[model samples]
Target: MKNFALFLVVCFLWSCNKDDQVETYTYTLGIPETMTKVEWRSQVAVQAPKPIASVGKIYAYQNYIFINEKHKGVHVIDNSDPTAPQVVSYINIPGNEDISIKNDFLYADNAIDLVVFDISNINLIHEVERLEDVFNYYSDYQMPAEVQAADYSNFDADSQVIVGWRVEERTEIVNYNESFFSDNSLATNTVGTGGSLARFQIVNDFLYTVGSFELKTFDISNLSQPNLVNTNTAGWNIETMFHADGFLYLGGSNGMFINSIANPAAPEYVSMFTHWDGCDPVVVDGDYAYLTLRGGNACGQELSTLEVIDISDKSNPTLVAQHALDSPYGLGFKGNDLFVCDGASGLKIYDKTNPLDLQLLHVFSDVQATDVIPLEDRLLMISDAALYQYNYDDQNNIVLLSTFNLN
Candidate 1:
């Protein structure tokens, strides 16, 4: 009886093992693409202001607010009355993300080209000039399961620029045993300040923009005609750029780089403060730099913290203090008060008069904040679905001004 029971147990184990060893297969999928050309230029026209559907970056110029519509265009709004801000015009720019204004001229990226527009007359805005192929990085597309297992030999880089993407269903066979991993500035004049999430900045007469691996410089000395002067290879995953004094502070996934813009057209590397890999945005005040590093998603690090670095000495930046945060994103400053958008935790206001002992003053926990731009007494906060404006009192109390919905 004991031998019969042992044989039955062995048979059961074999059957279970066989069931778990079923053959696995991989398949190729198709992905849809929106392609454009490097020479493509669109005439700036005044379209009936459309409701905000997507929010990318927000910029304030005088009483006007310019909000980016991701890869679409800029929505010009008259914010003279914060209580009743109205959308004035929509500047149709394809593959657009960032915008900066100087001396009535608006600078924005239209795919591979840097297109400048005359916003002095908002109703009759027109494209003045386009610097072709200044920006080379294109938006990535989703790869279908079928395309993932197939060759990208059909991708044509010569004539078309991929602007949008969608995945389609298809099939191909492949061995499923292996695992796969994928990884992925400006001006001066009366230029409006972008959020800490900005990649474009205008400092003096030069416009600086940081790409995934390079910093492209353009001479905005001639407002209508921006001349591409120099391109410097920055580190990988360069995310945001900020100008303080004569320095260009760059926040990358891996570190914070300080470049001297003493020569506005030619930036020289000053120093770099390294940290764990993550998506980061930086803002500076006085002698200290506030950097927020967030984890999860494609950022690659599991850390969520705010780092304060002393930059009195530009050549060497030292980490002065560190504070653990909850998924912090873009940040900005109003005087000594630091406004941090802590994702789901909402907007956190910190008094950084003393960088070493940072104090939290307030937090609007109800809002899902991602980035902030503090303009004078008003604060502009961007979430996934809305653009919010606020007015702060002398005692640091915030008053809700208005909200523009982006569904």
Candidate 2:
């Protein structure tokens, strides 16, 4: 009987250690990839539209819209008929991401350089200039924290450019501190969707863009030749940018930064509205500035929230309202309505007439929305699966206008 009891105890200990034990789990891991300078700077041109890698920034001009496929190129979509939009063409710009339109010319970043395109004739769009090595803050190959990375400590940076990543998978026992989810992310945005998540914004004759931690300004007065004028240390983890009234608003992982572009070429740092760390994008309407804090497996933030700040005074932005959110991403305004794209929770329309107590008007929960650009009564939304257009003429009865497949 004593021998039998000892045998049972040994079996339990072995089972706990070998089968039922040590906390761990499986997660998709990513490794940084590098490309030869020669390959990265391959000849770029305009081609017919093909399936884009992913949606990045968005820009609207007249009846056209530009969508970004990070490190790949930009697509020109003809939304002349929103109900039946057409893919016009594709700008084959290697290592491209953000874009902004001004006076028929489109400004885009191509890795460490700024490329300008003459789109006056959409049918024959052509590249006019390639300003090299200007974007010192260019971070095109940033991978997610959720994906455990392999070491590449001795990687060469002189002749190799980090173009993308190599993703793979492996399993381990479930660890309480480890994490994994659908797609290994709520959504990475690839380039982060919508105009609200736009890295570039054109205000006046100056083009402003925010990198990971700096503000880069370009003088686009020459249209065809945009020269890099100023590169100012913006803030830590700066992600998105917006131009409202006469100021440039930069949204980062930790807070909102306001800069005076009074001297377009040289933006002067004004103030910052601090908040909990998260991936965010700031959008402004009239006297108030709106942003959403999206915490996710990739973002590393603790909570999802919506914050509204009074920006009447650019130097001292005051937070007057704070609301809880369900994994919010991008936000935009349509007159009195505020559209919040809350990941899987859906696209929520709020009546901001009462900012202190925002009234939830409606929710389009069928789609996994990422960001939005409210154009007139029509809303342009980018999600994980597609680029969606909606008609919100009837605020209470918002209807899907059309969709362009992204995946």
Candidate 3:
């Protein structure tokens, strides 16, 4: 019989390579570590508002749903028909927050500039260049104990003529010495200093910006003259940076940095995975790295966390689990699920295919989500300024296939 059809074609090619092998499910939470109450409370069946106030992410494309308002800017929802989501347009842009689009252009960012829109007129989209002062020459740091000189904890014995008039006061205070503090001093308004604008990403044609400790690299292939090319020093505050395969996974407040751009205008650090510090947000696949640490304090001490790391041995990184959510700001991943915007633990969902057993599953709560995008079937597409579409029912409940109001 032709040797039994070659043993059934080698058992159907070994059962189709064990069903396309990528199976690594490890989610646990059979509740009952003495079960610390959580009877369940997450419901927001629907909501759609976008005249803007403080939204953060949502992009569904192919019928629209672009929102990004976190201080206003971008909102265009129509979604053709993902079950009716309509708000048409509200592309304002006044102090935008975050946005991305790639192909047809749309790379917003406010609180200190970087814009580029032209949705190819998805319905009259506009603007196409903004890029302000690119940090207008950042220079304001202080913190060497804020130029100390006194506080030897009430020293006395004539404290050497009051420590020689506070060590001849002024190791340096700039900004015209801020009227000598004490108007409720924390350096009393200390203008022009420290750092901000600490995050941006879009590797591959480059855009990588970040501040509060430098790390730029523009050259958007010429998004109307981007060109900056390379300059590193991001010792931290690099908010986010994922890329993949060729690695570039940063996350900030000085922790995870992994660069190895394979030579995209020279980049090659490849190592570093500290954790728990501040404002971190990262997501990666094909070797794992899904971080989140929402700033620091603790929870009441401020900042909350949720980590899941296992960089597939990327220079030995490991700590496959840690969750204590509260302010876990934005971190999206689709496919083994892991979405967290937690500005109060609102849009959290985690399964993470066992990166050491991470499994939360669902949460929708009070609408302060921030960002989360995943649109193919079970649909999920969130953002705060207006554009939400959860839908995950069959009993797991979480309905609301659409709601688009991008004001």
Against the true structure, whose TM-score is highest?
1
Comparing 2 with 3 on TM-score, the higher-scoring candidate is 2
- Model 3, TM vs. native: 0.28
Model 2, 227-278: lDDT tens digits are 7888899887788888887788899877899998777789999999998778
Model 2 misplaced regions, further than 4 Å: 1-33, 144-158, 164-198
Model 3 scores worst on lDDT over the 10 consecutive residues at: 1-10
Q: How far is candidate 2 from the true structure (C-alpha RMSD, Å)?
A: 10.7
User: Can you give the TM-score per candidate against the true fold?
Assistant: 0.83, 0.80, 0.28
lDDT score, candidate 3, position 255: 79
Model 1 segments more than 4 A misplaced: 1-40, 43-45, 139-152, 166-198
Worst 10 residues of 2 by lDDT: 2-11
Across 328-401, the per-residue lDDT of candidate 1 in tens digits comes to 98999988889999999999998988999999999899999989989987898889888799997563558999
**RMSD of every prediction:** 11.4, 10.7, 27.9
